[model samples]
Target: MLCQLEDDWTLFTLVFAVALLVPRSPLRFCGLVAALYVLWPAFRFRQAPPWNARQVIRPAGDTGSPMVSVIAHRGGGHDAPENTVAAIREASKNGASGVELDVGFTADGVAVLMHDDTVDRTTDGSGELSQMSFFQLAKLDAAAKHRLRDAFAGEKVPTLEEAVEECLKLGLTIYFDVKGHADQAAAVLKELYMKHPALYDTSVVCSFEPRVIYRMRQADPDVVTALTHRPWSLSRFGDGIPRFSSLWRHRWATLMDVLLDWAHHHLLWRLCGTSAILVQKDSISPDYVQYWARKRVALVAWTVNTAVEKQYYQDVLHVNYMTDSLLGDCDAHY
Candidate 1:
């Protein structure tokens, strides 16, 4: 972790470090308890050696076969209520390769499938999700106010365990976006990992927090952990600059989208020990990807929803994986 943590994990640490400081805790891991109500994620996929059997991309137009899994972002948010079971099951039926959803703890400490702290966007309920109990949350509608009502008027907010069982039944893989604080979130993931070993194989813990990723990596390096990034996260590494221009204004724009450079290599060598990073490919320019690749950083893009986006990642950008909203479009098998 980039930030140092206390040696002991305790209630004091929870009260002072997480609650009073950092500030993001209350918004992320909502509720708290000693059991199932305590919110969390699973560490199953991390057990696999991700780099062991990397697949080389087949040439384009292998006639667009339905080979690899298509990952639906938040239950393919465009088509249904984001994160609802109906939405996820819908994704499975659509032949999606897998589903991607964000999770956060509720006010009472139970982990739930939620992308935000406030429920106003996706539910009839208002205020923070952390403020409610499971029964109270269940009473509110999970359906958003789009064309998806009526069919999903009574969808209950899904618990992490419930989501896992449903996904298991569909025989699908998942990439879990654990959006929260470092240690607490890790604690939650650890709890789930102990409960379900099988879920770890096809799941990954993703976040913008390097500390969170590092902690999870330390606990279980085999689990797949992808680092989300804002431009600031790349700054110290040195190669992250130069996005001050548009692609037309930028130099070396052929492919890889250049996010790092020779300067970055020297920069990362001084700090990170290694230049290779697990990053979301969508946020950066092709030039940025080229820059990071030059620094030996492995790239993975997010929310790839169209053929053009797919082409950008596969044919033009050549990233490690294109995390898309649909399963049939992507081909990351390893």
Candidate 2:
């Protein structure tokens, strides 16, 4: 709740600051225009029903397959320190078919498990992951910042190689959420997959950046890949303005999001050789679900935490889904 309030405040301040740049009458007009520009799309989408009438097309040789795989978001985040070995093990124990973990590079180009650019939020240390060497990161306790720190204390950040070894040993599927440093990360993934060819059939490489997914396809066409999507409303600018990021300061993030959306809606998956589409839960509708299913593109929903939402996606939508919690409806057939 506090975070939400802070986001709202930040957004308001940004708008007011911009408005102050204009003359009085034009300022009021500009404010009104901005309000409409932002709110109109959200209002329309909320009132609109899920698109369900479009005819789905499947390219030759493509076939629809029913998939009900249970994926752990951040490797069962609620049950363990996310992106750690403990979380991977717990997800497998909880019956998850696979685990999704984020990958980033340290200062020395060592690939490690991390969702944020900085370790401040998820570790006892305070510093950018990209600025710290792996040796430096190795000393920080990764689990100290988790809610169940006592249970997972002393858990150090695991390297991409270590994570792969653990997942392979446990016979669990690995979903690599490429955060950045795509080229470097792709090299690490390709090397590991080459070492264990069996992973080719069990692992998936997914990311919000199309270039990253495209690069992975270039590295190994046989490797399964997915493109993640979030609707404009749920995007970085959806709830409130983003103040701290360089992307926001330059105002290019929103433009990139628009282009990405166009690509997703236009079936860019075919060109990128992606076998799946990972979408935000609320942004999905019956239409696109059926459409993707017909295209032989597996659909995966993310961060679904509530039982009702889980049942709706699994039972009604009949698509694979990822969840933060390892308990409740999410645990039913994991």
lDDT by residue for model 1 (1-334), tens: 2211121123234445444455455545344322212321232122235342122111122566423335677777666677878878988888665677777787677778988888888788888877778778878788855356877777878988888778878866666677776676777777777677765565667665556666666665555565554343432222455644566544444122334332233322222222134444435677877865553445555656667776666566665343434534443211
User: Which residue pairs clash in candidate 2?
Assistant: 51-287, 95-334
Task: Tell me the number of clashing residue pairs for each predicted model.
Answer: 39, 2
**Candidate 1: worst-modelled 10 consecutive residues by lDDT:** 52-61
lDDT of 2 by residue, 19-73 (tens): 7786789767677768855763343211001111111111111254434677888
lDDT score for candidate 2 against the true structure: 0.74
Point out where model 2 deviates above 4 Å: 1-67, 233-256, 329-334
Residue 71, model 2, lDDT: 83
TM-score of model 1 vs. true structure: 0.62
